[model samples]
Target: MIYLQLFIVFFQIGLFSIGGGLAAIPLIQEQIVDTHAWLSISEFTDLITIAQMTPGPIAINSATFIGIRLAGFAGAVVATLAFITPSVILVMTLAYIYNRHKQLDAVQALLNSLKPAIVAFIASAGISILQTALVDTSQLPGAPFDYVALVLFILAFICLRKTKFDPILIMLSTGLVGGMIYLIL
Candidate 1:
């Protein structure tokens, strides 16, 4: 029953998660954390971090990790397949429609509308993650936030916006700096 439920939940996530994996974060959080209680908020946040750091799509990585934690290897397979199936079908359908009506004004208008929705989804996900990362609610009433993390976040933002440095290099440098800070503190 749990296996079936996992598949159905992930299938729905895949089917309606327009604009790709990042867009699916809110849905995933809703189902896995709020609805089913499969993972706590902090665990979900950690999952997102690990998913981003690892290879492949964030959705697939999350599905695999949660599935394996819940059941086993077979569960991982089921969740992954369920998460990807809708995307595969939709891509094929959209490809055909787009090829046939590539020049239609309505199709172009619809595509244009989707851009803002995609941006909204991405922004929501970013804010969610940022809140979790910068706020340490477990601390005392007066010390509920991680100032160092906020500083690092601002520095990273500035580096990415102001410098033409490679993103990978920035991430690596930040990781090193964060590790050193951890050691010092």
Candidate 2:
């Protein structure tokens, strides 16, 4: 029953969450924090840090970690399958439709319209996560926002906006700095 429940819940999340992993954070936060009671916000925060540091997409890493935590190896397998099913279906279906509709301007235009909406959704998710991470509201006093975090966030943004270097390096450096700051302060 737990396995089935895990699959259904994650399937719903994966099916509805558009614009990829960071965009999925809001939903992940809701389910993990509010619905299941499997993990706290702090746990989710730690899970995210682990997910980002390892290989593969953030969403997949999270599914595996949280799933296993919830129900062991079976849970991990269940969550991973559930999480990816929707995307696999979507991409395959869209590819078929796109090939058939390639000659149609209206079909292309619709995709273009969706692009902006996806960007907006992703931006909203990023802001929500940032607020949770960088804010020191009364709700989560223990995880107060550190000054080092703010500095790194700004510096990384500057580097990204100015330099042509690969983004992964910047993320790794920031993650390391964040870990050090989190531990020391």
Candidate 3:
């Protein structure tokens, strides 16, 4: 039953996560965190961090992590396969159609129309994660904000926007600083 549920959930995530892995974050959060209650918000945030730091697509990474956490290796296999199956099928089909229709204005227009929605999905995911990182919502009216997180976020944003430094370097530097701060205090 759990395997079946995992398949169905990840399959749906893959099928509708049209803008790629970043776009899948909200859907993953909805189904895994809100619907299944398999993980708390903090766990989901950590999952996102680990997923981003790893090599694969975020959605696939998330599927593997959640599946293994819930049901071990076999569950990881089922969830990962289910999450990618739709993308494989869709990409193959779409490649054929796109090649055939590459010159059509309607096709170009359709592609252009999707850009805004994709931006929205990415922004929504960013804001959700930023909120989680910056504030402890569980404490409600008097929750203390994470000033250190805010400072790191601003510095990272500036570095990305204004400098040619590799993003991985920025992340590693910030992670090191943040870890030290937390360890010391």
Candidate 4:
């Protein structure tokens, strides 16, 4: 039953999350955090962080992590497979269509039209994560903001935009600094 549920959830995520992993974050959060209550917002935030840091795509990584948390290795396999199945089918079909009609103006227009929606999805995901990272939403009425996180976020953004530094370096440096700050306070 749990395995079935896992498969259904992740399969839906794969089917509808059209703009790739970053854009899938909100859907993932909705299913895992809101619908299932399998993970809290903080846990979802951690999951996203771990998913980003890991090798694979975020959606697949999230499925594996949530599956293991819920029902162990077999669950992980089921969730991972379910999450990828739609993408595999869709890509193959789309690839064939695209190759056949590569020069069609309508096809190009359709593709171009999807770009804005994808950007919106990514931005929504980023805002959600940023809220979780910077503000204590659990403390609602007068939640204290994490200044350290804001500083790190700004610095990371600046580094990526202006310095051409590897993202991993920024992440590691901020992570280390955040850890030290937390330890001291």
Model 3's TM-score against the true structure? 0.56
Residue-level lDDT tens digits of model 2 in 25-58: 7898888779988898989999999999999999
- List, residue by residue over 39-115, the lDDT tens digit for candidate 4: 99998899789988999888889889989988999999999999999989989998999999979999999989999
Reference-based TM-score of each model:
0.54, 0.54, 0.56, 0.56
**lDDT: the better of candidates 1 and 4:** 4
Best-fitting candidate, measured by lDDT? 3
Q: In what order do the candidates fall by lDDT, top score first?
A: 3, 4, 1, 2
Candidate 3 lDDT over residue span 66-157, tens digit each:
89988999999999999999989988999999999989999999999999999999999999999999999999998899999999999999
TM-score of 1: 0.54
Candidate 2 residue 134 C-alpha distance from true site, Å: 30
How far in Å is the alpha carbon of 156 misplaced in model 1? 1.1
Compose the digit string of candidate 1's lDDT tens values, residues 10-117: 999998888878999999999999999999999999999999899999988998888887779988888899999998997899899999998999999999999999
Candidate 3: segments with Cα more than 4 A from true spot: 1-87
What TM-score, to 2 decimals, does candidate 2 have?
A: 0.54
| Residue 11, model 1, lDDT | 96
Q: Residue 143 in candidate 1 has what lDDT?
A: 52
